[model samples]
Target: MPLVSVRQNWIVLLVFVALVLGIGMVVGLVAAPGTYVRELKMPDLVLPDAVSGILGLVLSVAFAIAGWRTWVIDSNSTEMRLWLATLILSWWFSPAFFIMRMPALALCIVAALFVLMVWFEFRTWRRDRPSFWLMSPSVVYIAYVAAMTAAIVAMN
Candidate 1:
């Protein structure tokens, strides 16, 4: 198998970020007409709940795939366990944030999950020296989650 380098992993991370942002913009545009946008004074921006669920679903899938790929590449039992936990926790975050309408609590939960993911990746990197690409996805995920949380909190 071809060895994946840190640079390659960074490229992958950038691609994933682009994909997530692109999807979000597309979804926002498509759902905009039906969405009720609330203007926030602090950030001077509009918040819409219309595509929140869809964005959540997209992020969940991306995280799952990233976790699965990392697990597969590392072949570590601990990594596998962490990936499963992240996947399950992430899957629940969307509904809790959007459907239950508890953005703050949901953000906390997801933040914890992101921390866990980073710890897992760090451990795997130390033990197995897997490509940085394996860990980059977690970084991207965390950034995305943080941005969403900021938007949610600002809107509220």
Candidate 2:
């Protein structure tokens, strides 16, 4: 592995960022919100589209870096794999709700992600207390979205 001197792990971090953003963009475009989304009875807490977009991008990138951090700590650790699962499921959330127009399915996916978020926080609390606290925004965002999705499911 000497020949692969692309050291400092920048390559790995870039790969994670690219993968998260790339898949996210593709899914978002493909699942571009339609009448179904507008027709749903959205929760009062829902933010404006621009605000949501900015917040979403921030959270998504934050999660990507978090995943990369896990890999850096121990690429083979179950924690890293859990982060990967969380990212993949998060990416699919839009498609499930916007593309497939299945609020119920989306709710389930989000619920699973929320559970994973809790597990992740518990795991990180021991190793990196700051990171656990840093993830508060992410946890709140997921919970807020989950609530919104549930509202949609119940409304229509």
Candidate 3:
């Protein structure tokens, strides 16, 4: 059996979006006003928070598209699970970095995760050449993370 049907994939994606929005609303309204201000002190050269957020959202959508394509082509592949897990973990790294105020640690974690993602993508591509393009969004995400890390380092 497939990991998730096409319809189920859409449902999961919708649910993920809803969860993110709900969390955002809670953080914006319920959390202390200065919560984020205290946690994230980014340099001016880095993109503004809103712009970086939008970029992350766009990149996430791209990853979703890639995941959907992978599901359509071969939902049973183990790589699909790895792709999904990597997506979820990628979502965590930003909060983990900014909220924890540990750029060096976060950079190390991100680097490790990037290596793992690349390895998974390579395995998937080797097993199924047709799905090679699915890796592009993952690469973009890694690049984004790297840029963020560099900006954080430059700030100090």
lDDT of each: 0.57, 0.80, 0.62
Tens digit of lDDT per residue, candidate 3, span 34-129? 454455556555666688668656655655655665666666767777766666665555555656556676677787678767766686676644
As a whole number from 0 to 100, the lDDT of residue 135 in candidate 3 is 61
Evaluate residue 154 in candidate 3 and report its C-alpha lDDT on the 0 to 100 scale.
60
Q: List model 2 lDDT by residue over 1-156, tens digit each.
A: 011122688789789888988898898888889787777887787789899899988877777777777777777877777777788888778888988888899999999999988888888777655446656688999999899889888878
Residue pairs that clash (backbone atoms under 3 angstroms), model 1: none
User: How much is 146 displaced in model 2, in angstroms?
Assistant: 0.6
State residue 32's C-alpha deviation in candidate 1, in Å.
Answer: 13
Residue 92 error for model 2, in Å? 2.1
Across 1-156, the per-residue lDDT of candidate 1 in tens digits comes to 324354546655555456545654554444442212243222433334456456555654455445444644554577767766665565555555545556677778778787877877776675544433555655675767667676767667
- lDDT, candidate 3, at 2: 27
TM values, all candidates: 0.54, 0.89, 0.62
What is candidate 1's CA lDDT for residue 86? 62
Q: Give the deviation of candidate 1 from the true structure as CA RMSD.
A: 7.7
